[model samples]
Target: MKLNSAQLGKHLQGKLAAVYAVSGDDPLLCQEAADTIRSSARSQGFSERQVFHCDASFDWSLLYEAGASLSLFAEQRLIELRIPGGKPGDKGSSALIDYLARPAEDTLLLISLPKLDGSAQKTKWAKALIDNADAVFVQIWPVETAQLPHWISQRLAQTGLSASQDAVELIADRVEGNLLAAAQEIEKIKLLADGTPIDADYVLACVADSARFDVFGLIEACLNGDAVHALRMLDGLRGEGVEPLFLCAMLARELRLLSGLALQISQGTTPDRAFAAARPPVWDKRKPPLHKALQRHSAGRFNHFLLELQQVDAQVKGQAAGDPWSSLARLCLQLAGQRLLLEA
Candidate 1:
């Protein structure tokens, strides 16, 4: 059966499937699903599990060998095959097709992939897995601007602490919809709330740590149209081990927030009100830069920049070649300017 990350906890309650295939773009959610299956398999008396990584030169026979192997403890065995590249290409595809035709009974099989594309999802190998195993796809699309508040509420719920509705909305505005970043901030709230409900102050204190003296600061400087400071901040962030892609993701989030706010402005929402209505209030320090961004970038231009950042994000994740950090730096520089190339 197919299940989403949110549904896994309840779905795995009593079901014990022998074969599972989890594929997705969200690392945290995808890993959680895989971990759930592995944990369930262990509790179901699968005492031994062999793991294999599939690369360009991986042999089909290795899968068969693992399948044929028995547990020394006289229990059902589990075989976990991780294909980080997602699509296994022609040879691996053929091997998987053949294996699925008559899978092993004594050994439970689980297949994991980093993320699968639409074309790969329609392939015969993927189809066979869906037919024979419990297949799951975890898609992490960007959340809608209006729905961000509800998203923050649900995320905060995961940590057994709830934020006031206004507080949640405030936080959402502060961090926007970058789930990973939002998650990080929420975790901080859980740590500091000390059983009290999280509020706006709790969020501001922990939401923008990197902003203090790094790339975030640079981005803020750029937002405020201070090119010199932005450049310095970028260098500092790079020196501190924050990956180029990570900075790209954060900047993209900021730009996206600006775009959304700009849209609201076009509809006659005042800047002060926009900041107030933000799921999370914009940091007092960040306000200067963000205000400059609003002044500098038209809504359409900001949207273009945001899309470019998304593509940069994909490239940095190895979806495309070339130097990701260099590519990211160029994009940042362009955004720091008044406009950016729509395509890179």
Candidate 2:
């Protein structure tokens, strides 16, 4: 069965499905949808949970193993498989199809992916999930710019506070359609304003610029080869208290993809063929900018990015010298085809 994000909460109030596939670009809503499922399951005696983050090297057999293993701690289990890359290659597709053929009893398998494009929706694994009688597919869409104020107003009501009309408009304008930032700002105002109704002045005092410079934006800047913009975004992200390890992890995902593409090219595969043959099959829209990035770095350079991420991880864990943020800046600069001469 298929449902929108709005229908998920009500649906969960009834019987829980054996499997769920949640896909969307709205991170906050997607996360909340997954959380709602877990919470509902927990209340009904699901005390055990396991999570898997799927990448190119992920072993699909684990899905079968996890399903077969009985959890001793609880009567039910919540198994979440997150595919940030979205495309579950041949093995993943087959595993999902086979597993969905007979979903385990007393286990809720939640598979989360980025928003599915037309072609992705037609894949065999996607069909297995969506076409199943016992599965629920929830598609979360982003809050459009025009709907921002109403969305903020709804969130405020849920947070046990109301906001003046001007205050809602000011926040909607400042956040520029970034739901995560808007959510954070609303939570902040809840603390500062207490039970008092929020106003335009209160919002202005409490929120920052609200133009989110998240890891995704930083990656786009690097891919587009805008070194200066990338640096500015890096600075903004760090100043906003984004963790160095989080940034490195995201950057590393991109670098690993690039490395695979570069390696294929070095083996005489045409860029077009390399992208098409890519494990997660590079979507057509991303191929252009990725092609640009591929030209800026070779297989060896992309391998070096893996090494740099290792160092950044160590720095974050306090197991190494030098600042992690500095290392991240250097990596970003190099990815954007610029070498930093001074301290990053």
Candidate 3:
């Protein structure tokens, strides 16, 4: 049966399913759900544990062997299978289907995977796992901006610390869209709280800017024409020791995407149609900013930025005699519609 992270606790309290599939893009939620299952399994006499990470060269037969082999240590066993890329090839698909046909007795299977899209959900193997009566499928969703404050408040309450509304709001703003960071911040607050009710002032003083700021956020800000915020985030990332090469790589990637989308639009495709056809499939939340960037910059302009990014890449590797960070800042400003006197 399908369940959410919140419902998994109550569901586990009753009876443990033979197979538990926990999937989500949110690392914190997925890890927590897996931890809950592990704890539950241990309490039910699952003492032997085996973990397998499915990578490109993984042997699918080992999964079967793990299930078939009797544990030398304990009667009940917990087998953890993690698929980082969320796609099991033809062999894996067949193996999984065959194994789930009749899961071994006294063995609890826990599969962890990244979020599967619609196409993946329709696969034969995924269908078998989800439709199987003995399996419990739990999908954890990322907390949206609107729900983050309440999520933070709930997490704080769990730690025996009550926070004022302002404090919760402050924490939410600092860690928006990054639940892992939010959890860590909550732990930090718990240590600093000393049983005192958390206030905005205390949070402001103790909590660092642990918000999920990545190269993607920088790209979104630039695309949306928010130069100030984009530059501020750039500085914040730089201060946090983000590498210039990584920054250049992200800038180049976005420039390539914008160029491709612009080319499609120039060839008589509508922005909406072009966006849908773009590789990696730009998410709905990102469509607005991407559309804005495409409208503001032509294909040729994006190509020009791509060339500039190449130069920045060389400077980052110390092969070119220029300031990579300065060039990055200039490129960001230009992308955000500012006219800057940047050297070639």
* Residue pairs with backbone atoms closer than 3 Å in model 3 (clashes): none
What TM-score would each prediction reach against the true structure? 0.59, 0.65, 0.86
Tell me model 2's lDDT, rounded to 2 decimals.
Answer: 0.89
Off by over 4 Å in 2: 213-344
Model 3 ranges off by over 4 Å: 241-249, 270-288, 300-327, 337-344
- For all candidates, the clash counts are 11, 0, 0
- Write candidate 3's Cα lDDT for 1-344 as tens digits: 89999899999898789999999998899999999999999999999999999987889999889989989999999999899999988888998999899998999999999998787889999999999999998998888889999999899888888889999999988876789999999999888878776899999899988765678888888999999878988988898899998898788888998999999999999988888898887776689898888878899999999998999998988889999888899899989988875433
In model 3, what lDDT does residue 77 have? 96
lDDT of 2 by residue, 60-129 (tens): 9999999999888888999999999999898999999999998998999999999998888998889889
Q: Could you tell me how far off, in angstroms, the CA of residue 175 lies in candidate 3 after the best superposition?
A: 2.5
RMSD of 1: 13.3
Clashes of 2: 0
lDDT by residue (tens digit), candidate 1, 1-344: 55656776676677666667877666655666788888988887888878989888888789877766666875688888889888788888888888787787767788887656566778998877766654444343345668778878988887798877768877776664556667777887778789765777766665674333466666766776766556666666667788777787688778778888888888999998888777787755467768877887778988887777777777877887677666666656666673435543
RMSD (Cα, Å) for all candidates, in order, is: 13.3, 8.8, 3.7
TM-score of 2: 0.65
lDDT of each: 0.72, 0.89, 0.90
Highest-TM-score candidate: 3
TM-score for candidate 1: 0.59
